[model samples]
Target: MDDRTAEYLVYLDATLTEIAGLARRGRDAYDRDIAVSRACQYNLIRLTADLERLGSDWLAHHPDIPWRLIKGMRNRIAHDYLTIDDDIIWAVVEHHATQLHHALENEIATAKTTLHTDEQTP
Candidate 1:
């Protein structure tokens, strides 16, 4: 893998960890507190951008993920910031973020293994 890809994997992992912590307060807390909700949404926007920067090759390798939707979400959150639906954002936080986190963790592990193997080659 390229150095940029490795760097992004590290960033993605860290961002997801932060998001998970942010959402640990659960839906009620998230919904009740505008700060928590906005924090989660902001990180998601960053996450989506990071995924896009990971390049087409990285994305194509992980076809199982909803790349377009992820990108679209960033746009929605940014463009429709005023009228953004709390329920949908909460759902994305509770559901999709966890899924994406796990998927990224797996991809990072696989990439690390491959990198190690390459280094070991003659």
Candidate 2:
């Protein structure tokens, strides 16, 4: 991976970590607290936006990442906030975010290996 892609992956990993932390607060807090829900949404948006910055070529290499669905969610959150469903957000936080985080971790590890290999090659 190139430096820019590596940077974006790191950022996405961090944002997913933040979302995971918020998720640990549990469903009750998420349902009752606007702050918790909004924080999750905001972090998700940030995560998706950074995914966009990873560039098409990099995104293409990782076809399993659900690039379209991820970006669609970001658009829904950014452009249609009022109609956003709490249940969907909660589902994403509880399940999808965790899965995505794991995938991101793998990607980060691969990126590090790629960088190391590139360094050694020269």
Candidate 3:
């Protein structure tokens, strides 16, 4: 991966951490009717943009991840925010988190290692 992809990968991983914390913020989101979940959902959308912006090289290697659904989710949030389903967000938080977490963490660490290698080479 190139430098920008590495930065985006770090962003993605940090966003996942934020999502995981937001998931645990449950009821708080429901009680005050907090927009935290919605905000976290937006972060997911942003992460997808980061993915898209990373371009073909990143996508080619991580083709197994849901790039399309992610983009769609972002569109839904941006254009159809009113009908946003809490359950779907919850499900993504519960199930998708682990899968995303693993991938993001690995990609970020690999990127960092490569960056370090490049620095040492010079």
Instruction: Put down candidate 2 lDDT per residue, 1-122, tens digits, no spaces.
Output: 67667767777878888988998999999989989988999987998888888888878888888878888888899999988888888888889989988877878887667766777995
Alpha-carbon TM-score of each model against the true structure: 0.84, 0.85, 0.80
Error of 3 at 12 (Å): 1.2
The TM-score of candidate 2 is 0.85
Model 3 segments more than 4 A misplaced: 27-32, 116-122
* lDDT per residue as tens, model 3, 1-113: 78767777777777778778777777457436557766777777876777787787768878788888888878888899898887776777756865788866767898778
RMSD of each: 3.1, 2.8, 2.4
Candidate 1, residue 26: how far the Cα is off, in Å: 0.9
lDDT of each: 0.83, 0.84, 0.75
Best-performing candidate as measured by lDDT? 2
Q: How far is candidate 2 from the true structure (C-alpha RMSD, Å)?
A: 2.8
Q: For candidate 3, which ten residues in a row score worst on lDDT?
A: 25-34
Worst lDDT window (10 residues) for model 2?
110-119
Maximum-TM-score candidate = 2
Off-target runs (Cα >4 Å) in candidate 2 are: 110-122
Candidate 1 has an lDDT of 0.83
